[model samples]
Target: MTTTSKLIHGYEVVIGFETHTQLATQSKIFSRAPTAFGAEPNTQACAVDLALPGTLPVMNREAVACAIKLGLALGSHIAPVSIFARKNYFYPDLPKGYQISQFEIPVVQGGEVEFFLGDEKKTVRLVRAHLEEDAGKSLHEDFIGQSGIDLNRAGTPLLEIVTEPDMRSSEEAVAYAKELHKIVTWIGICDGNMQEGSFRCDANVSVRKPGQPLGTRREIKNLNSFKFMQQAIDYEIRWQIEQIEDGHAIQQATVLFDPDTGETRAMRTKEDAADYRYFPDPDLPPLHISERWVQEERALMAELPRAMAARFVADYSLPEYDATTLTQSKAMAAYFEAVAKACSQPKLASNWIMGEVSRRLNMAEIGMEQVPVSAAQLAALIARIADGTISNNAAKQVFDALWNGESADVDAVIESKGLKQMNDTGALEKIVDEVIAANADNVAQFRAGKDKAFNALVGQIMKASKGKANPQQVNELLRARLAG
Candidate 1:
């Protein structure tokens, strides 16, 4: 129910998302078929999936458990009893004429996803998350005039998460999607892989004038990547506004995003609930859950991201932003904790991980598990800086060498590079005295209350010391000499 006052081309865009999260299970939803990817066409499907006679669908207990885990993570209501229904549709990809899904009541009901959009907090409400079986993929490649069907993905378990119309901009939609992705993956329910179709998003976009009725929405389907998701929504908003301005009414339909042209094209007319002809499945019975089971599952669940972030704030004395960023992924949080524990400098650990480490990881397009620099090596490097063995810039040089695998040992790199700070008081005093004697005019300017002159003198001292002098010591010594 979140509304925005911002407008684009004198129209406000309304957006909602429907995300399908594939459960991380070894078997299909109702059969014993393996759920591994990249198998040959029609290899993984089984009799139940093919809807052969004398075969009845059996519910996957693990899939239900995964749904429960997601509900607990999102603070949703886990229904005590839910029913399965058959959604009748005609598509070449669907082996069974009807697809089994939840209707009237779903396992998860009414949750909220909260995320930050550049310091402003936003929340998106959930309509429901229902368990359903995925249809097979229709492949059009590798054939001259005919297409092929890959039923390997048929009968795969999917949790369709429907959201209320809350997002107003493309950025907010992306943020909300990312937060949802993080939660699902964090709870060990979904893999959150967009490449393999493990996670998919469909955005319902519309535009209207301020305080006007909601416009007809066209759903952009199968947005596999966040970049494409943002692009598709932005384009759709512009297109809808343009259409309305030209006195053409918006049509409700399903659309596809063409990444090559950066435009969305209509696929087919959108179908309402009645179009599917949903009815309770005669084969499957009502799904029932007890309070004891819910409590047991909750107890076994790992600490959630928000709770972990709060703990980091209270225990490590970290800023809220630092805590939140570190807890974005479980692997990242573990790496930060290891570094902080090894060095006993929580703030320093947070800074290094958020700064240089994040930059390198993003450039390489890899996860924290693939980081070239280990926690132990980073902790040792931070220790050198903390003990004044090297300045910040010098430490960065040592870090670069270690990261590039030039040297594995921190102390060795520091020694080989000759990055040790100049801590000799007598040597520093001599250089300071020479600079003061040579720059009498600059010294007079400093005495006349010019701060820039003093900074220039400090810079000269640093330059004379071959960039090895302790900057703080130089500042203190220069200030004392000038005052005297």
Candidate 2:
């Protein structure tokens, strides 16, 4: 929830989220089918997945463990006993007439997702996160006026995380989605690959006038990219506002966003719980988990992102923002730690990594994993800057050489490019004296209590040193001369 005002056309936009995170299991939840991506259509699905006769559904223990892991990470209560139900539906992709999912009693009960909306902390309450098997995809392309069914994803295990209507604006919704993405990927339960359909989000968007009852909502399905997520939500908000303003009622339906058109179109009427006719599956017994098993899984859980970020703030004295950004991924956190430890300058390391390093990575359209420079190289560069061996500007040149594969050794790059800072005390003093004599007017202004004039004199000295002078040393010596 956000206290900040986010009203569009005198209407407050209400949003909820439903995210499907594909578990990193080797096999399907109730079958022996392989869960790998990019397999040939219908090749990976087995008899049990296809609902063939003489096949009985058997639950996978690993999937249950994954559910337990998510419950612990979100601070949710893991149900000691849960049931699987057959949700009756019909589609070309579903081999069976019904899909298996959790309806009445979900595994993970109630939790909250906390994230920062700019500088404000916001939390979205979770309704439930339940284990379900995904329906196969209906492929429209590569066909002549006919659709194709791909059952490879039919039986994949998924954790459906539902959120309350806590987001007030599209920005908050996007922020919440990204934070959830980082958590799932950090905990090793999901790959967070949007392109590969590993993680997907459905946004339930509605708009209502302040103090009015909740508006009818439309769900935008399969928003695979964060950029598109924001755009889709924003568009839907505007559309709903316009419809209400025109004296028309908003209809509840399922919609799809056309990225090319940048608008949402109605697909079909949305279905309620009664329409699905859910009933407990007869073949499978009640899914039960003992307290001992929950403890065992909790003991083996990895450190969550929020906890790690808090640790960085406490141990290294970093700002909360820096810690969060550095821990976006495990590899990124490891790289930052190595650089900070090697140079013994946590703030400097944070600045460089977040600024220049991130700029280069974004411009190249790659992640930290594909970054060309090694941690050791960056550490040595920062160490030189700390020791006054090179000016900050000179260090950039050295970094460029290292990043461009011109040289591997930091010292070699410094020497070859003549980037070493001028450390000769006597020579610097003489340069200070010459600049003072030539700038009598500026000197008079400085004596008259003008700080800008003093800065001008320091700039002259740095220019005379060919941008190689240590700025702090120059400032100190100039201050001493003026006082004398």
lDDT values, one for every candidate: 0.93, 0.91
RMSD per candidate (Å) reads 1.9, 1.7
True-structure lDDT of candidate 1: 0.93
Model 1, span 381-460: residue lDDT tens: 99999988899999889989988999999999999989999999999999999999989989999999998999999989
Q: What is the per-residue lDDT of model 2 for residues 1-484, given as tens digits with 9 covering 90 to 100?
A: 4446589978998999999999999999999899999988899999988888998889989989988888888899999999999999999888888999999999999888877776677888999999999989898975578788888998899999999988889999999999999888888889999999889999999998888988999999999999999999999999999998999999999999999999999999999999999999998788898999999998998888788889989989999888888888888898999999998988899999999999989998999998888999999999999999999999999988988999999999999999999999998999999999999999999999999999999999999998888899999999999999
Q: Please report the TM-score between candidate 2 and the true structure.
A: 0.96
Off by more than 4 A, model 2: 1-3, 141-143, 448-450
Best by lDDT: 1
lDDT score at residue 416, model 1, on the 0-100 scale: 95
CA shift of 245, model 1, Å = 1.7
Lowest lDDT 10-residue stretch of candidate 1: 1-10
Clashing pairs in 1: none
Reference-based TM-score of each model: 0.95, 0.96
